[model samples]
Target: MEQPYTLEPYQRCGLASLGLAALRAEYPGLSWHTLGGHFRSSQPFWAAIGANVPGGYEQRGVCSHVTSS
Candidate 1:
């Protein structure tokens, strides 16, 4: 999944969180994975959503693992 964007006026209103919640509800067993360096600045966000950045190299980047809740 790509980083979610909201208009400047709508930033930090939990819109992205809400959307992710809905997606989880729809796909209960879904898992999210991405390259570690793809969104280097969003590490906190990924962690907040329960994603784990495991140690080790994945291809050319690190591995990001998001297990289903």
Candidate 2:
């Protein structure tokens, strides 16, 4: 789930939560994983949804991989 931004009038009114909820309902039992730097900003949301971050690697700021499920 990337940043759930909306137009000025629609910001911060639970739209993101509703979208995520719909996705979860559509894809039951599927594992959602996000890579490296995204982990930094999204950690809280992932934790709230019970996601687990197993490990990650960064190679000279060129290549990176982070597994969260």
Against the true structure, whose TM-score is highest? 1
Overall local distance difference test of candidate 1: 0.55
TM-score of 2: 0.43
Candidate 2, residue 40: CA error in Å? 6.5
lDDT of each model, Cα atoms only? 0.55, 0.50
Candidate 1 TM-score, true structure as reference? 0.51
Clashing pairs in 2: none
Query: What is the C-alpha lDDT profile of model 1 across 1-69, one tens digit per residue?
Result: 654557989866767667777877898767554423546655555555544323321324333454444
Against the true structure, candidate 2 has what lDDT? 0.50
Best by lDDT: 1
* Model 2 misplacement above 4 A: 1-4, 39-69
